[model samples]
Target chain A: MLSLFATDFIENSLMKFIQTSGLMAIFSEGGYKYVIMICISLLLLYLAIKHKFEPLLLLPIAFGMLLTNLPGANMFHAELFAGGHVHWDIFVGKAGLIDYLYLGVKLGIYPCLIFVGVGAMTDFGPLIANPKSFLLGAAAQLGIFLTFIGAIALGFTPAEAASIGIIGGADGPTSIFLTSKLAPDLLGPIAIAAYSYMALVPVIQPPIMRALTTKKERMIKMSQLRQVSKTEKIIFPLVITIIISLLLPDAAPLIGCLMLGNLMKECGVVDRLSKTVQNELMNIVVIFLGISVGATATAASFLNPRTLGILALGIIAFGCGTAGGVLLAKFMNLFLKDGKKINPLIGSAGVSAVPMAARVSQTVGQKDNPSNFLLMHAMGPNVAGVVGSAVAAGILLCMLG
Target chain B: MTLFVIDYPLPWSNILLIALFGIAIVFVVLVVLVYIMRLFGYVFTRKHKVTNTKAPLAISEEEVVAIVTALRLYNSALHDKESDMLTINRITRMYSPWNSKIHGLTQMPEHHNK
Candidate 1:
């Protein structure tokens, strides 16, 4: 009798342990999907580590995806944020590590903070020197609107379409800000697409740039820009923040934060604050933002036809954006006089990848004419692309939010 | 700020309208910025020009040159004459256990016989 009781106790304990193990959950019904999601995450990890494709964000994002997909770990709960509204009643009981971090994204705080860092690091001297670059910046947004129509035609809702179209902006934080507001469901795919394409700016932009412009147009050397004064530099961020915020109040958070950062940098009064924002604050927010955004890519959300469609449409949007900038620049040359004729090559930099896009313009131009240096000229449109995309995001929010 | 809210899918016409109007607004806003920046540039440049005109140098070019040359000569005269030589001096110091090679090396096992 004693031996039987001991045997029974041991058997029950073993059964309970086996039943509760995460490994067992993986082998249960409907478990293959989790395996697939995990595999995808691992693939992204490989890409991030080996290729260095936006590694800072992608690595954390990939790890978050891995954590959330571990069947029984329960690090993230999508139902808590179901239907694009946080279920605060159950949030405290059901929330996990990622849910807490995701609030920064849902509350529209992380992206704006990231923008402040970007602003501090940016030098607006180029854009201020050549205001016409604003036109090219506006022109690059053609991809965004065009993709909006395409996504709608392909059967996404207007809000979802807007979120997907923002990938063309080539501004990652702006993409996240718009998507988190307009369609939180699609945030994972849209962010991955935006960053991946941004990393590929050098690869993707050059072919389109080469195809669009003739050798002569590529070789066209722009005259040097006038020296921008310290006063103009200080006044620029203030004026831009006020004008853009007042015009489209929807853009206030992003534009205001960005301008504040630029002010901190240009004013030279708060060097420590500028350094902290540019380095420490930016790094912390990026880690949190990346992980939370990546955690959203569950099997149900990511392993679908829509993800495939977003990836396809995203590249199309990027291509169209590149073509738009180049074409607009060529068109502008028709009106611009001889010395003032703009190089169509610099137009491709209007996609807002910042110094990367500008560098591509320089590289392609140098290939055609060794003497040509389009980096500074390209920077004008590149920075303008940042403002242009913010305006586009604001417009989309007003129309479709 | 939302113009309209649609629970149902939007029609093709509305989609097109949003696209067209969105692009148009972006252009209009940026164009306004272009004009404003241009005006700002004009104002600042005009201020610089006025400052330049108002601040004509009191000293003539010849006088300035003469002053600079005399200052250069006086500065040269302040230095005492020395032999034109370049030398790297070596200084010796007493050894300390902190930096001595014997202290840095591991001690070898001592041979013992019983």
Candidate 2:
């Protein structure tokens, strides 16, 4: 009788352990999809670590993907944020670590915060020096609107299409801000696509830039930008904030935060605050934003034809954006006289990848005319692209949200 | 809140219209910003030019040059003439217990063989 009781206890304990193991869950129904997602995450990690492809954000994103897809780990719960609404009542009881962190993304806080950091680090002097760069910046947004049409034609709903199209903005925070608002389900893919394409800016933009402009256009050397005054710099943020907010109320959060950071940096009185936003706050928010956004890429959401479609449309958006900037520059040259003629190559920098796209313009121009320097000139459109993208995002939110 | 209450998979016409409107709005806002910035530049540049033109010259160029030259000559006169020679000087110090090398060194003791 004693032996039998001991044997029964042992048998029940073993069964429970086997039933609860994550390995068992992996072997269960529809388990291969998780395997594939894990593999994809690993590949991203390899790319980030080995090739240094936007590793600051990509590393955390890949780790989050790995964590969330682990069977039975329960680090993230999709049901909590299903139907594009947060189930606040059950959130506390059922939410995991990532689900809690994800609120930053869901409530549209992280991206705006990141914008504050980007603003603090940015020098609006370039954009201010050459206000005409605003035109090139506006031209690049052609990608966002054009991609919207393409995504919709591919059968995505308007909201989904809008989120997907934002990848062309080439601004990750803006893409996340817009995506999290419009199509929360597609956040993972859109963010991955946006950042990935931004990392590949040098690779993707050059071919299109080469095709659009002639050798003469590439060799055109722009005159130096005017020296912007301190007083003008101080007034810029205030005027832009008021004007943009009044014009597109939806854009207030992003543009407001951005201008506030810039003001802190330019005003010369808040060095501590500016430094904090640019470094510490930026790093903390980036970690939370990356992980939560990555957690959204469950096997179900990521392993689909839609993901493939997003990747395809994302490249198209970038191509159109680059072409738009280059083409508009060429068109503007028709009005500009000899000394003032714009270099079409610099127009491609209007896609807002910051210094990277601008550097590409400089490099390609240098190859054509080794004496030419386009970095500073290209920066005008580069910074303008940031504002242009923010405005475009606001419009999308107004029309589609 | 969204301004439009459109159905999913919007009609082709509406999609095209939205695209056009969106791009137009972006361009309009940026163009407006460009003009405002240009205005700011114009006003500031004009103010700078006015400030320059309004300020009277304190002295003529020749007079300014003459003053600078005189100041330079006076400053040069203030410095004493130096002999163009570099020399090494040697000094000897009185010996003290603190300065003695023998006192500073620790000497090893010799052991007599048994």
Candidate 3:
């Protein structure tokens, strides 16, 4: 009787342990997809920490991917997201903690909020001093259009193609904003591709920039940018907001928040508010945005063939955008005088990756001529690229969404 | 006529056309912005130049010297003569979380005590 009781107790304990184990779900439920996704997440984490690839967002995103993919964790419920439509009631009541935070992304709030912080931090002086850089900024968006065509060729929807193409703009927030609205289903792949390519700007842009430009072009020195007055700085954001809003209302939210932040910064009385927006608000939103965006990279969505296509197209978009900017500069040089010739390398800074692309231009230019300081000159196109990409996103939203 | 208007089912012709149109719009808008910025620069700089060229007040050198001396004496009398730089000791205090501008929506907490 004692022997029989002991056997029964052991059997019961073993069955309970097997039933409750996460490892068991890996085999029985998620199967191979779970293993593959876990490996991908680990790879992303390695890239984020070991390689220091945009770790601010990448680390959270990678961890979120890991958390959601762990079999039987029930952290992210796909049923809550139905056919590009979020069932808020289900998400709120049935889903895990991460799902609630993800609502900001689903509703396209986080990216716009991030733009507000970006605008507050950005100085429009460089752009205002040399307004012609706006052309380079516009020219850099060529990759977005080119990639849109490529995505379509690969059988993606117009909406999906538009989202993918915006990755070329190299602005992470703009990419997320457009993707959330146009092709929410492809948000994870598109956002990751956008950010990953943005982090890779220092690597990807230099080779193209060097190949396209002759030694003379790289060594060409630009004139000093003029100092912009406070009045012009204050007026810039307000005027831009009104003009862009009138032309493309779809861009208004992103542009409007950005301008509002800039206005607060330039208005001179709201230093405290501007500082808060730049630091605290930006940090908090980035944390939430990173984790939530990462959580969306499920095996079902991320492992698809479409994602592979997007990753491929993203690099092409970035490369083409760089080329377009450089080529435009060369084209403009034809019209310029001997002393007024613009450095073709400055044009590569026009892809909206901000200071990174601009810094890369400076680095490459300095390699050819150590005395050359292209930082400020490159900043003109660099900042203009932000406005250009926002405008491009607005146009895409107007056309496709 | 609208060339290759975007609609559901996303035809390649429409997608290509949209891309062209999109690029056109980006260029046109930026061109407009560039011109506007140039206009602003012209107006502001021209105004600045005009202001710079305006005649100065006709104060004699003696009067200017007198004014400068008086101002310097006044500053010396009121300010610290020993230290070139002003020293400030900030009060260290613990406050509620609401003191953070990030937390409080109404107003930022004052740095110095009233």
Worst 10 residues of 2 chain A by lDDT: A153-162
Candidate 2 local lDDT, residue A70: 94
Per model, how much of the real contact set is kept?
A: 0.70, 0.71, 0.71
**Taking the candidates in order, what DockQ does each have?**
0.35, 0.33, 0.29
- Pick the DockQ winner: 1
Which should have the higher DockQ, number 1 or number 3? 1
lDDT at position A93, candidate 2: 99
Q: After superposition, how far is residue A316 of candidate 2 from its true place, in Å?
A: 0.4
Writing each residue's lDDT as its tens digit, candidate 1 over A243-328 gives: 99999999889889999999999999999999999999999999999999999998888888889989998998899999999999
Runs off by more than 4 Å, candidate 2: A1-3, B1-8, B78-114
Tens-digit per-residue lDDT, A35-85, candidate 3: 898898899899999999889888888888888888778887767876777
Better of 1 and 3 by lDDT: 1
Model 2, A350-388: lDDT tens digits are: 999988999999999999999999999999899899999
Chain B TM-score, model 1, reads: 0.57
